[model samples]
Target: MIPLSRNSAVFGLNIDPIGHHNGAWRHPLTQVSRAYDISYSLELSRMADAAGLDMVFIADGLSVNRYAPDSVVLGFEPLTLLSAVAVNTRNVGLVCTVSSTFTEPYNLARMMSSLDRISHGRAAWNVVTTANPNAALNFGPETLPDHDSRYERAAEFLDVATALWTGWQADAVVADKDRGMYFDPDRVAVTGHHGQFFTVEGPLNAPRSPQGKPVIVQAGASATGRDFAARYADIVYMVSQDLEDAKAYYQDIKRRARDHGRAESDILVIMSVRVLVEQHDNAAQERAAELAELVSAEATLKRVSSFIGVDLTRYALDDVLPPLPEADDIQGYRTQLALVRRLVQSGQVRTLRELATRLNGGQGVLSFTGDGRSVCDNLQLWFEEKAADGFMILPQQTQRDAENFVKFSLPVIRSKPFGRQRPEGATFRSRLFG
Candidate 1:
């Protein structure tokens, strides 16, 4: 097994204005009007930087559905948004999702490399083979490629992207005004890549950024997904409903990394967790209950149906969740389908109503609700036990809850007893894997 570092745990802030909970926009504390405002995201990113968090992650989807009107349907494009945030924050890493299926490898390489330079080496790319079927119509295809085929394309895309990022050597630039020689052509080379998904001819136009390359991140949980991550991803985002499963996944992925001829410690597994923090335990509980009450059964069914690519509305709310089609059959999020099945098979969830409620609140993410100290304790347990290298904090209510975490939980987490210290690295990659 790969042993975790005893140093401070890595942390990332998921800057979703609507929050991770389905009912977050309905919460009184959330500023629903500013969900699309760049100022709002800048404030959050600045807060994360002040709190000494390692990164700020922005998730994006190419298509929207009418069934989940309250969901985050409209927002700034991720790369563009991250570019803005990059200018506003100094220390925090800027990670954004850009789909391999929808984007060309050459364009992606240039954008990420530019962001890396703009952020002074604080950039990471979350690689995804978009699962949304509606995305196809926008991209001139009737449907998304099959699951395995999508992964195949993503693998080749990464190969080309990485090659472009590294094609120019560090010593390639040697400005000599006396000789009028700005750079050494011999030090740079072309990728000349001709792969199944893409064909790129030469080196990228941009010079290498401070970090050598933007950190590669992946967040898929299928068999092919796992293999792809093991082979290429530097950081991985995972979804787990409980501790046992989290540990199992952590070990499994680390093992896969070893099998791929990479050190287990080379990849960091950060679990996505929703947190609700209040000054007192009772108030936090009340806050969670209030959010739960706002969950609409009809809306939940529609959202869930779209997620698994099945019409769950056909069944009654209280009906036992029927057997699902194979993961290969679903064009949407297959990992979400697997999570639902695991919950049912373990008897942790009984009916469509329960599953809907769970997904609506955390999207099947593990949730911790408590006062600041208690929340810190829960995180410490997970970090020390090796269930997670760190956590991607998804606040239930964005502004207020995020402030509470930074104010109360962060200091406690950074205290000496916890041994959590700011990473000493000058670049984002060094901070993550130094």
Candidate 2:
């Protein structure tokens, strides 16, 4: 079982091909061409593994935004890429995004189950409801479900998938050579799930996984989403701009989890943070500014439009953002939209360009730009305050940034009083909880 260690924060890296910054592919540090090759992903995951990080996450999108095509294209299917990464990196956990909305439960259960076994229990599934409305077109449904319906469907989807995973008992696979028996049939169960969104027949054809069940990861920020996460997720990914908000989210999720009769440790709240590391603070800030300058405003607006189901192109760059639709009127990612909306309405952001810059360049996630030691000190404050169980490093640029984070932050992380010796050859579950 994965044990809890309050001292150490579970670090993770979102190893995107071109980094999380929209302009990463254009930066001097990133080689956009190499990211198209599988080797690039392998290299990043290997670095994460060496750093003793808990997990490496891969985000996936079902459809391409034709309106915002200038940004770097992440071509690899998350599962396919993580599968390759699984065989290559021995210790690090692999987390991949998969929508519960459009995918079949049985198919998803089988694939994730197999991946967990292949990775020897280092697999985590990031459950999503396919927030991008454009994705509906690609899935052969021009119209998308409303926000509440989507979460409802997702709840049922998780139920079916989780049931299928446990359909076969741990001892079901007993290859008795003398009797020519493959397994004990009595130990296998058929899920026989029939629900609002889907019906899944049980006993996954695969054997029970090493971890019994792959870790469950959830990232939903709305009230319904938070409650859903509290009920099922082992990990909750969040986006926050400051410590207070982070702490609030951390406490809220933990409280919601307790309400569901689950321990606070059962849910690991991981904040999505962009870390820009350099030899000096000034240099890091300059690199971040340069990367921001490279992002296309036209593309950024369209990307935002696709996300919030609002056409932002109608407004000029320098003009104050127009009044946004009510949160209920939105069918896309409501939590982030609400965050950004409050920023504009509260006079924190004066222009559309300013908010677009933050969304496109900063990825609507929080940022920490400084030299290695200084950056670690900032993270130390958050960790000690219980703002999060861990921080997922969303690099704004490629190779060098990740290299710097490891080269610089590793020593400090090791030196911290909370540091624990990594258990060798243990399942990712053990690494997290033990």
Candidate 3:
């Protein structure tokens, strides 16, 4: 058992306004800020930081106008937004997603390194593979790469990026004006990388960052993703619907981390959970219903079709699965199909629409409900069971929901000891591991 600390850590939120569920963006209180609205992002970032939370993370995509054009889309690139947030927040870590599949390791290295430096050690990178086929088209590809191939590229991409990050000695920059030297060239080594995915030559033009490299966070729940997280991730963001499954995944990843020669403490497993919080339980439940009602059945079906790579419109609401010999394109569809079968076997859901509702937000990602104390109690249960080291929170509808997390949940969390506190001015690594 991971011993409870003198104080439990406050959870951080990941705002996936559009990516989370169909109705999230349409919530009555949601601000329709342009996806890239820096001021809007900064407000949230500062709020989280002020709450004494660990970080604010943004999930990204290269493609525009996915799922439904009428709905909100990824407005600005995540790294760029992080840079804007860097100017506003003092303490909260800023993590941004970038795909190893589409970006060159060298550019990724430089960008993340610079952001870390600019933020004075508060930047992190969430490495991902671009899984959507539409992303491939947007990036000028005819088809998406196979699942295994994407991981293979990511492995090499990480290797090259790390080499580039380590290429510069921390003492390389010595601004000795009297001696007329800006930096010692001798201490910098060019990272000449030759790989299947990318070729790069570098000493990262940027100097060593505060944390050496931005904390490498990875999020994928697939087998290849698990392997990647075990090997490279400093923080692993996971999506699991149940505590039992969450624990199994957590233990498996930590074990894998040990096999890869990393201490379990070096890896922080963060489950992505959404909470629907209100002043009262009934109010909360009503809010959830309002949010659920905003969901467009057509949009949900389109998203499901996109996710499963089948025309869900053709099937009746209660139709059973057809054979999948023809739907060879969608990587996760196979898993979804299997899950549907199991749900049928278990009698949990009876229709495709019902399955879509269940799977929408809380399906893949863990979700919670009720007042603040209850939510914190549930979180403590997960932490006590070693189901997760912590969580990456996603609020269901409004920014007020996120604000409620900070206002109500955080105080209780910070008051109950669950993990060690870092010394003043501690690095993230120190804060996490010390």
Candidate 4:
């Protein structure tokens, strides 16, 4: 019932309808038929809200074929679904993914600003420059622009959109019911801007929301991506499995924030983690084994190949991976690319099949699998060592398993000194930054 103490680790959920595992739907308890309905999503968010997590994040992509893992498919557009969820949930933050690559700055700005207002300030945008090569065809381009080029465009896009968000001063609106004047013209002014990617004439049509604007969340692991996030992102999502790697990343981002004239605490670093929990450690391992049995070696290899931009069909699953591309040259999801390189070179996975199955859990972010107390213990270690300021919860193989997280893990967290049961601040930004 009480707020988490100052040093408690923050947490949020990235809800997966069926689940994040490729064979999640095969789980007997998951209501596969309910995965597509708006009611089901509302149920998911309500579960998080009731359990007292800080936010429920909905991830999106422009191309359906991009990352086409069979078991987990996002059912609705992030913005539209969040709009519906906004009116229903009272406490948890509503965060959605929006591509800075294909969208116009003006339109994206308007929608996000409107969502923030509609949600009464508990809104966040997971800004992305989509990496799918297939996504280019949908936008009339034959190919995705080179990685660096896309980041360049994204920098300009963010500048234009943010300017529009601040065009109206906080006190610009003065509704005088007796006189019937809706706003004061002098308080709002034109943005009057020109830029490389876009040119917007004036201020946005919508007024600022209760939180001033939507909190900026980003997930980019490349060198360029890191710099971009350092300059603007309020929260940075990472897919780091190893502790040393995670700490290095945390330090670099904090340093970059200082370079950008931001306080070290200005940027929040969130590590994505997979959770499989139960009443006892044995029950958790049995649950893990059950999910492992359903995994198909071939399907997983194909998925892994798509992520690293390599063709692995020629090699048998038992063979060692052929040399992989250096992390710097990887064109898609650099986070996954880094994981692949780590798994192979470290001899953690001696064969292709081991690597494929390893990546099956939310692209191989670290897994916290055991009883609730043990899971929280490990999470506290990550938090104390400066590996992460917080964590993004990736639900395991079923909707029931997802609920299992709230039911089992949260109570333990509430009892632990370093664990938090509820979101910290009144608004999404305040919760993250303050």
- Runs in model 1 with CA error above 4 Å? 1-7, 416-419
- Give the number of the best model, judged by lDDT: 1
Which ten residues in a row are the worst by lDDT in model 1? Answer: 1-10
Residue 124 of model 2 has an lDDT of 91
Local accuracy of candidate 3 as per-residue lDDT tens digits, 1-434: 23435344535677554335557777767766634566667777888777667778888766665436755677778898889888887877888899998888889999998888888887788888877776888777888888878889999998999999998899999999999999999999888887787888887888899888888898656666787899999899876655676798899999999999998888889888888787677877887788777765556666656655667777876675444332234464343443344454556666666766776543345567778877778888888888888888887764667777777776666656663333323455544555
- The weakest ten consecutive residues by lDDT in model 3 span 419-428
**Candidate 3, clashing residue pairs?**
5-417, 5-418, 5-419, 6-417, 7-416, 7-417, 7-418, 8-416, 191-202
Stretches off by above 4 angstroms in model 3 are 1-10, 16-19, 34-36, 65-67, 177-179, 296-298, 321-347, 360-363, 419-425
User: What tens-digit string does per-residue lDDT give for candidate 1 at 282-373?
Assistant: 99999888998887776777777777777888999899888887765676798787787788878888888888876756567878888988
Error of 1 at 88 (Å): 1.5
RMSD per model, one decimal: 2.6, 2.3, 3.3, 2.0
lDDT tens readout by residue for model 4, 184-211: 8788878887877787887899888778
C-alpha lDDT values of all predictions? 0.84, 0.82, 0.73, 0.82
Which of 1 and 3 is ahead in TM-score?
Answer: 1
Top candidate by TM-score: 1
TM-score leaderboard ranking: 1, 4, 2, 3
